[model samples]
Target: MKLSKRLQQVAELVPEGAVLADIGSDHAYLPVYLVEQGRIRQAVAGELNQGPYESAQRTVREAGLSHLIEVRKGDGLAVLGAGEASAVAICGMGGGTIVDILSAGRDKLAGVQCLILQPMTDSDRLRKWLHDNGWRIAAEELVVDEGILYEIVQAEPGDERYKDSLWYEIGSVDLLKHHPLFPQKVSAAIKKIGRVLQNLRKSQGGLAAQKREALLQKKKRLEEVLKSCKQR
Candidate 1:
């Protein structure tokens, strides 16, 4: 019933006694661990393909949580009924894909109290999607398992806009500043923006100049955030 650092952070976001639905639940480790820890009362593990579906079933069965955790073969939140899950966890997927899943299953989220998402990339787009769809980023977590950094976004039903468009690209500085990896996260983002700017400098396209200017502004904002944190 052990969970990986990434999944463990997602698990931590689930409120106690919640009925959680885990999307793309490969191996079903998160649900098993949550149930074992008495963190949740029940869970539904959803897998899109047969291989992972069977793997999840086996994991739940082996853990003897068959009575508590149901393994379903389906795509995204299709395995869930409206109001069936109070919390949903989607981990280890690209942000765009996670956003699409949530978009397509909007009906199934009628009563979902929280969404715990771990996006492998496009964190900016994911944040934008949440803001547009009335989900407020309640809390954020940063954890690096092995050498890879992962971000876990815990959101609840609400609507809130960032200070400007840039906050979506880099999450709320106030929320992220508390994490031990805050500096690393900001530096990594700055590095990424720098690489893009360097590529833009070589581009002959009409929009390259405009894009570079915007990214440069973003990078400056990130540095300012880092410096402000240090001054505190």
Candidate 2:
């Protein structure tokens, strides 16, 4: 039932007493840990690829929680039925892929109460998608695990208007500012975007300048936030 720091963060956001769906559930570790802790009574682990899918099945079987957790092999939300689970957790995937899965399975999400997601990259795109598609950020956390930093987001059905555009880039400062790794997280973001700017400097092609300018602005904002976090 032991989980990595990143998965542990995602597990913290899962609501208790609800059926959870773990999408792209590698080895189905999160669900197994949740069930073992009595945080949830049931879960459906969905894996897209065959190898991971079988691995999930074996994990569930070996844990002797087969009755409590169902390991399903299917792509995205295809293995999930409409309103079958209240909490849907999609982790260990790219933001765009998560968006595409959620978009394609809108009907299956009819009765979903909340969504817990951990995107490997392009979290800004995922946050923007949540705002555009009638969901509000309930909670967010930045955790450094195994020398890598990860973001865990818990969203619910609602609406919101961000006070500043930076919210999309670094998640809501109000929620993430208190994290121990907040400054480090902002610094990491600045460094990542800075690398993109470095590559853009080599290409002056169509829109490259415009894109670089936008990234520079984002980097500036992030640097400002990082400075503030340090001051605090």
Best-matching candidate per TM-score: 1
Q: What is the C-alpha lDDT profile of model 2 across 144-222, one tens digit per residue?
A: 8889888888999999868798888788999888778889888888999989988888997679988998899889889
Question: In model 1, which range of ten residues has the least summed lDDT?
Answer: 163-172
Q: TM-score for model 2?
A: 0.92
Model 1 has how many clashing residue pairs? 0
How many clashing pairs does model 2 include? 0
Tens digits of lDDT, candidate 1, 83-152? 9999999999999999999999999999999999999999999999999998999999999999998999
Candidate 2: list runs displaced more than 4 Å.
196-213
- Angstrom error of the Cα, residue 26, model 1: value is 0.4
lDDT of each: 0.91, 0.91
